[model samples]
Target: MALEQLSALKYGKKTDLSAKLMNIHTKLRRYAAVHSGHANMQTTLCALAVDEDERAFAVNVGDSRMYRCRGGCIRQLSTDQSLVQMLYEQGRITADEKKTHAQKNVIFPVLGNASEEPQPCITEIIGGVQRGDIIIICSDGLSDYITQGEFEEILALPMRLPRRIAKLAEAAIKNGSPDNVSVVGVSMV
Candidate 1:
C-alpha cells in the first residue's frame, strides 16, 4: 500500500479543498494502478478541511482518522474502512475489541494496488474550531499504537504539533509498528 500525508496553510481557495483532495485521490489511484500493480485494491482518502470563515472545520476520509481532544473529551472525527469496522457496524465486534482485533488494520480501501479499478471511500465530520484546537491526520500505524485517550494526553502537553507528531512516530516504533508510520498534526493558532 502507498502512504501520503500533507498539511498546508490556507491561503486561497479555502472552499475548494474538497475538490483538490478528490483530485489528489484520482491521481493517486492512477499511479497506484500503473506502478503498484494492485488494480483491484481499494483506496482510502482521509482529509481535514479547516474553514476559519465559517468558524468550523470539516473532516473527510475513507480510512484515515482525525481526532480532537478538548477539555476532557476525546473525540474521533473519521471512520475506518476495514472489515473490522464493518463488523463493528454490524454489531459483530465489541467496542472494546475494535482496536485490539487482529484485523483492525485490514482496511477495505487503501491508497495503492494495481489489479483492478480503485474505488476510494469517503467520510466527513464537521464542528466548530477553537483557537487551540488540535487536529490529527494519521495512518493506522500511529492510530493503532496510541489510543484516542493517549493522544488527548499527548496533545495536552505544551508542545508544538510537529514535535507531537514526532512523538507519535516514536510511540509507534516503541509499540512495534510493522508498517510505515505517518502522522500530521495541525493546530489552530
Candidate 2:
C-alpha cells in the first residue's frame, strides 16, 4: 500500500520530498484502517531517495534505519521511534543501556498503526552523496546487529555495492542477529 502511494512521485513535476513522504504516511494510515479490521497491523520503513544531482532525501518510521558513510566515517541518519530511544532521549537510560534494554524492539511509530498514525522523520541532505559516499537503508534486523564502525569498514572497502551488501548481511548473521535482515546499498556513480 505504501509502495502504491509512493509510485506517483515521478509522474508529475518534482515536489518537496518531505511533503511527498507525509502524503504517503497519511495514505498508509488510511489503508491500514480500511484493511486491518482491528488486528493491529504495522510495519516499519526506512528508505532513501537520491535525485539526479545526488541530492538525497529519506523517510523513517519505527525501528528501520538509514545511514550514510563517507570518508571512513558512518553516521545514523534517522532516529528510532522505539521505547529505548524514548528512554535514551529522556535521560532515563544510557546509550549503552539501549542496546541491552528489555524493550529495545518496542516501536510506536510504524507504517500502519491504527491507534496513532505515524509521522515519518523526513531528512534532506544539503549536498548529497559524492563519489565514494555510501547510503544504506535497512530494517532493524540489519541495524541491530551492525555497528556504525562496521558499516564504515565494509562500505569503504574496495568492492562493488552488491558485495558490500553481502558482507553486511554476513556480518549481521555472524553477530547473532536473530531477526530478518534486509539491506539496500547505494554508491554514487
The lDDT values for all models are: 0.64, 0.79
What is the C-alpha lDDT profile of model 2 across 1-189, one tens digit per residue? 666667656732265755766677677676657775735666777777666655677667778888888788888888898899999999999999999999888898676666676777777765666887788889888888988888888887787889999999999999999999998888766
How large an RMSD does model 1 have?
Answer: 4.2
Error of 2 at 48 (Å): 2.1
Least accurate 10 contiguous residues by lDDT in model 2: 11-20
On lDDT, the leading prediction is 2
Kindly give the number of clashing pairs for every candidate.
Answer: 9, 0
TM-score, every prediction = 0.72, 0.83
Q: Candidate 2: lDDT of 109?
A: 63
* Candidate 1, position 88, lDDT: 90
